[model samples]
Target: MSGDAVLDLAREGIWVMIIIGAPVMVVGLLVGVVIALFQALTQIQEMTLVFVPKILAIFVTLLLSLPFMGAILSGYMARIADMIVTGG
Candidate 1:
């Protein structure tokens, strides 16, 4: 493939990664922010307090979003594979 085709594939790969990861990351960020706020308001400065809830929240979100994530990834992979086969 040409340089432009390679670059296009790379860009699509990055976008797929972002799309696949965004929901879980966004959920974790929201949870972490809320937890941080709570800790600040309560003056509870436990170092470990930040991790467990975020982990659980992210896990739960992943579970909930698994099908959607799988579909997106599958579609991207299929498109990429097709592009490769067609020498795009």
Candidate 2:
């Protein structure tokens, strides 16, 4: 493949990664912020308090987004495989 083709593949790979990860990252960020605010208001300051909820929330989000994520990943993989097969 040409350098431009390689670069395009790399760029597309990164875009796919971002698209797949964005939901989880966004959920984690929102959960963390809410937990922070709650902690501030209640002054609990428990370490596990911060971790458990975020983990659970992200896990739930991951579960919910699994199909969407799978489709995206599969599509990317198919594109890559097609490129490989066609000798691009």
Candidate 3:
């Protein structure tokens, strides 16, 4: 592949990675902030308090987003395969 094509592919790979990870990251951040606020308000200060809910929320978000994520990845893979077949 030409250098430009390689760079473009690399850029696309990074974009796809970010797109796939964004939802989980956002959910984790929100859950963590909410948990932190609750702990602050309730004065719980439990070290592990944020983990469970964050994990659960992330897990559920992943579950709910699985289909959409799969479609995106599948489309990316198809494009990669086409590039390979075309010797791009």
| Candidate 1 per-residue lDDT over residues 4-77, each given as its tens digit | 98898789889888988999999999999999999999999998999999999999999999999999889988
**Of models 2 and 3, which has the larger lDDT?**
2
- What's the TM for model 2? 0.95
Off-target runs (Cα >4 Å) in candidate 3 are: none
Candidate that beats the other on lDDT, 1 or 3, i.e. the better one: 3
For residues 1-88, write the lDDT of model 3, one tens digit per residue.
8999989988998999999999999999999999999999999989988889999999999999999899988998899899999999
Query: Which ten residues in a row are the worst by lDDT in model 2?
Result: 44-53
Query: What's the alpha carbon RMSD for model 3?
Result: 0.7
Sort by TM-score, top down from the best: 3, 2, 1
For candidate 1, the TM-score is 0.89
For candidate 1, the 10 contiguous residues with the lowest summed lDDT are 79-88
Extract clashing residue pairs from model 1.
none
> TM-scores for all candidates?
0.89, 0.95, 0.96
Report the error of model 3 at residue 13, Å.
Answer: 0.4
Better of 1 and 2 by lDDT: 2
Backbone atom clashes (below 3 Å) for every candidate = 0, 0, 0
